[model samples]
Target: MLDAGIYEQLSRLVIAMKQKSSQNMAGNRRSVQKGTSAEFSDFREYMPGDDLRRLDWNVYARSERMYIREYFEEKEAVVSVILDTSASMHYGKKSKAELAQDLCAVIAFLTLHHMDRLVLYDSSQMGTPLVVSGGKNALPKVLGWLQARTFSGTETDSFSAVRQMQRRGAGVTVIVSDFLTEAATDPTQDCLEKTMQYLDFTKQRPVLLQTLCAEELRVTMDGTRNLIDMESKEKLRVTMRADVIARYEQELQKLSVRLKKSASAAGGTYILCDSEKERRALILEDLRPLFV
Candidate 1:
């Protein structure tokens, strides 16, 4: 269950942030772009200063008056929250899966409070789209859908999921995941580079890559144990030698650097969150900076 006090605080935080920033919660600034609105977009001459793009060809064909179409301000921006509920997300001291859900709930509530449309999806066992709406009252349904979802042993296809979701229209696509997919030949570089292709697709705008974890930035595994792949159900027993642990830490840092670089290159925001922290500070101090 979500904490009511934290939810209320984050809602107010989003409102204040929107008010303070030049950026509006809606997709774009007020424009004369033709859309399904009552406001007149603009008038164009019978000729080409008019966008043949927005030309009322019907009016031109009938009255011989070549008036281009005009549009009104788009009211609501669609904000889609893609939450990763794969079994891998359940492996952490604070439980990454729960943190991902909480983050999703916070974002959904904030977007609805701002009158933006919200679409929620979980890509665990399979890609399951939960709900899409502009109603703040739908919070219960959203929360319930997430609450009822169990972490199953399923592989996450980030590339495929993002590709499919790209058709949902662009606004803000916030992906919350641990991002620990199977490594490739190049391991750190290959996984990130391939994943970034989907994020850079033309359809979506301002992708926010938020990685959640229960472990600290620097992970220190206690002792020798069996490491298992939650999705594949494969296990390996190994001892944590000092030098081996050092190398592991080095690789982890390299992975973080690669992820940050890739996200920046795609013109998106990346946030790393440890689920054990205070929720208020997590939003205000850590996650809020991404919006700015």
Candidate 2:
């Protein structure tokens, strides 16, 4: 559950969604096509068919050159957030599912505030997505829709989540999940790579936000305990020795490296978040570059 103060805090920032929408409409995101925005993209030599209003009088007067002022085109884009609701997401006291709910809500608000179309997709079902538009006024309904989602599935359908989306123009497609899918056989491949490739094929810019529990990342168990797989309900009773803990940490680190490497190959951004920590910091600090 997000607090009112958090909302106010987020209001200071903006969501940097991928600007790939070919069909342009007025919005905050800078598009490839030139349009009216204060931020200047670059200057192009005046062409015969160029809009006369864009002609730079100062450049013409000073350099005797016909230069046209070009600014980044502001355009509306579809901001589809694919949230994983598998049982593994519910593994911690401050569960990934809980963090995902709040993350999606913030994303929805940012998208709507800037007049971008918003859709929240459930990766667990990989079916209908909740489409929303409007400004801050729509936050309540968006929050309600998000909180209403049930995390019941044993696993996530990452492929279906990306493959099933009806392409809503070139924009950012954010997939938020624990991404705890069993390691790929080759170790060189992961589910995220396949998902990002599908997004690339569909012309949507993909961004992956991988969430893990603090407990999982910083394992501290010291005694023998029954470790249960939330997804399979399979339990294994084993002693938590120093060597076992060391191996687990190594594996987690390897997974992190692989995920980052995969994201680079796919030309997508990979972000890791601890469910117990404040997500706003991640958004405002690490993700601000994309928004620009």
Candidate 3:
């Protein structure tokens, strides 16, 4: 879904991790382990048998004590991009599914550009999700897989896809969805919190990307209309008015607040994506914080 120019722009960036990875695979990002690297980590008192090369000779000459310099070991991080393929994603004038796919592709490109592992998950996938690792050479497979994705799930639960994933190692997860689960419609439900807890239990730091269409954000319809639930296919007939539209907007605001709070509580961040915005701006500007 990305053009060559977009890929070129993304090549200079790499996905930044909030926590040091514990994976043993060699990579370009810093890890929890200490090893020989250009990036200095800290200094520790030199012990017998310690490599003399790492010893701070100047310190030894001044303070009469030896200390060894340490560097953070670089290791690859696994990034899981979960796309919600629920029918609601197909509702927007500009399909949220398409936006979600593009976002996932951008993340994949960044992860692979930095030589990190990437695992893509979608709700419509029957069993295991597609996993790919390599440099730019693997981008074709990622793009093809994303191209085949279709939003057809009938479940209203956005996290159902995530819940079904096999437990993965410690890493960062990017979940792209409209997040219009039962919790959004019913304030009493705790779907968002529960999903965050699950991700935490899986040893994952989640990045919730909530995509919405312009029509959903601002209602323009007036008087008698039939509302249909994209997922459940439930129908309701009601007279639309100014107060009704205002109430809907209020509920939407509350949903965004709840999602942001839950993501933060789970050691992650929440991003509200407006599908109508330029894709380049979203990836290059709004998502810049994700890259380093």
Candidate 4:
């Protein structure tokens, strides 16, 4: 969870950051102000002091009309934090589950602090998306809703929640998840492609955040054991050893690398978080720079 001190600093840092100039901004890209980017948002009748370079020469020549590009200021951004509550999320360390929840709390708190429209979505239960919208004052309510949630004890599609969500307008969509689901034959490619397409179609910027426990990075268990699937309750018997653990580590690294690359290819921010790190450290080192 976000502390009061860190909250204050993050609030100012994100809200006070200068808006991007529209004149040089690309079309369909996010900027500090809505419609301020030089990307043609709209056209208006030419007025005195209007930049001549912004005049639509083609329109004037074809229709004998005088018009200049008009850039409008973007209003308050809507920040939606999408969380995955899959059974796999519960499979990891207790700290991993707590950290995931903490991650959600921190991001939502920052979004609310910035005075943007903040909506929280969790897919632990399929079909029904728990959404709460409000300002910083509603932080308590959001946290309460999270506390009240009981995962269905079944698995779900994290991306399905994203597809069901309606974009109020173009804004930032942050996905917080373990990215492990039953639907993916290839978790990295399928999840990234589908998510990127959805965000692009909705005209919202994307931010992908993945949380993995230490066990996934480096195995600590040894000897013969029956590994139980937290969600499906299935069992797999295996003998743990140095070589097995090493191979697991190597595979996990490959998965992380692919997810990071996919995030970049989708034109968004990709961050891999260790569940063991302090929340404040994660915010300052990983999150603050992206917004500030």
Candidate 5:
């Protein structure tokens, strides 16, 4: 369960972020269509049939340049929040699955509050898509959907999931997952290339990757224990020596670094979240900048 105070804080942070920058969606966000909004952007040379009122008289008088002021188009964006419900997400210190749900709920609430459409997708259920049109009544349904969901699925095939979402059309795609899927049969580069081809075909809108976990980032486990794959139920038992632990940590860091690089190469924003941190602050301080 999410704390009321945290929810309130998340609301405030989003509000504050919106206030700070009018250009919140300028470069990173794609518009659905052009519309009238009196936010002056740039001056362009007047074209035939241009509005007379938009002509810059001052520039016309000083430099004799027939320039017209252009304003940015204010278009509403559709935000789709995709949460990975795979078994691996259920094993984090603070439960990555729960955190993903909470984050998705908060984002959906904020997007609707700002008059943007919200869509929720669970990869486990490929056919049914949960959509909420931006309005006052949407929040209840969004929250309920998050609460009712149970994370008990097997492995997550992120590339396949991305392809599925793309077929539904373009929008801001926010994917939340640990991204530690089984190695593809093909080379990593080859797999990514194929995925990118599909993503291109569907024209996926701006993508943001959020990886959630606590223990995955830093290992503090000691002594002999059984380490099991949450999805596969495959277990490995071994004595944990200090040297072995150090080597494991190094490998984990390498994997994380590779994942981050892959996301960047795919023209997406990547954010790693420690599940135990204050969710609001983490969202505000680390993730909000990518959107803004």
Candidate 6:
């Protein structure tokens, strides 16, 4: 999904996490727990049995108070990329499912390049996800899995699939979906809220990647036509007048605003991307915030 130049730029970047990871394995990213790394953290007063090697002798000479120098520990992080394959994603000019696949590839490359763990999930099934770790050598496996996949699920709930997966070390959780699914009781926004809450509760840093097609954002065709629901296959006939399209756009904007607000309030990042954009632009510009 990415070109050679994009890969070169990505090599210099690591997956950025606002909160430190709790994984104990040796890695490049700093961990929430303190250990012996070159990076320095804040200091505290030295205890009676503290290590003399960590004592700041210079501070002791000036203030006459012994203090211990601490450093942040580096640890590996797990990045879970969940793809929503619902049929609704199959709509649009470029198709949301295709965009989601491209994003998953980029995320996989970044995670592996940085020596972190990677997990791949999809809405098509509820089972074990393809887990890979090591260096960039493992990238082909991820790509192969993505290539063999297709999006045609009618009633699959990707969030439920995520909840069913065995939990791993707390790190980054990137969800790529259209966020269009609605339950009988829970609305679209409410379902997203509950999913974010669960991710937060599991110590995972949430990163929501919302994909939408150009057609969904704007409707230019005005006439009496029939539209079918991709998921339900329910058909409806209506006159697509200017006013009708205008009202639909307004409501869509309100929903977008609410989704953005909900993601921010949950201590996560939300990015809405159009499927028609070039893969290069999406990686270098739109997705830059995801990297450090």
Highest lDDT model number: 3
Give per-model TM-scores.
Answer: 0.75, 0.79, 0.82, 0.74, 0.72, 0.81
Model 1 clash count equals 2
Write candidate 5's Cα lDDT for 1-292 as tens digits.
5566655555543321211111113322334424457766767676433458878999999998898776666534556667888888888768888778877876776676666556788879856768666454688888888888888899977667766662333445667777677542233445544554454344443344555566776667779989898888999997889898888677666656665555556554556777888876776676674454
Please give me the total number of clashing residue pairs in predicted model 6.
Answer: 0
Better of 1 and 3 by TM-score: 3
Give me the overall lDDT of model 3. Answer: 0.79
Who wins the TM-score comparison?
3
lDDT tens digits by residue: candidate 1, 170-240:
35667787766654114634655665655556434334444555453555676788988888889999787
Please list the residue runs of candidate 2 whose C-alpha ends up more than 4 Å from where it truly belongs after superposition.
24-26, 30-74, 183-190, 279-283, 286-290
Clashing pairs in 5: none
Each model's lDDT: 0.62, 0.73, 0.79, 0.65, 0.63, 0.77
Q: Write the per-residue lDDT of candidate 6 for residues 1-292, one digit (tens) a residue.
A: 5566877877887777756765534567767767765777657776332458878899999999997776677767789888887788889879888888888988999998887888888767647578787779999999899877778888666566668865665788888888766531244446667777888788777887889898987687788989989888999997999889988788667657766776677677888888988888877898877877
Give residue 56's error in model 5 in angstroms.
41
Worst 10 residues of 1 by lDDT: 15-24
Model 3 alpha-carbon miss at residue 196, Å: 1.9
When 3 and 6 are scored with TM-score, the better candidate is 3
Give the lowest summed-lDDT range of ten residues in model 3. Answer: 42-51
Candidate 5 Cα outliers beyond 4 Å, as residue runs: 4-32, 35-75, 166-168, 184-189, 192-210
lDDT of 3 by residue, 1-292 (tens): 6567998988888776767765545677777777755777667776433457878888899999987766667767789887888888887788788889899989998888887778888777736688777677998999999888878887646666677765445788888888777755577877778889888877788898989998898678899999998778899998898888898899899889988898889888888898888899888998876766
Q: Is candidate 2 or candidate 6 better by lDDT?
A: 6
Worst 10 residues of 2 by lDDT: 16-25
Residue 12 of model 5, lDDT score: 46
Steric overlap count per candidate:
2, 2, 0, 8, 0, 0
lDDT sort, best first: 3, 6, 2, 4, 5, 1
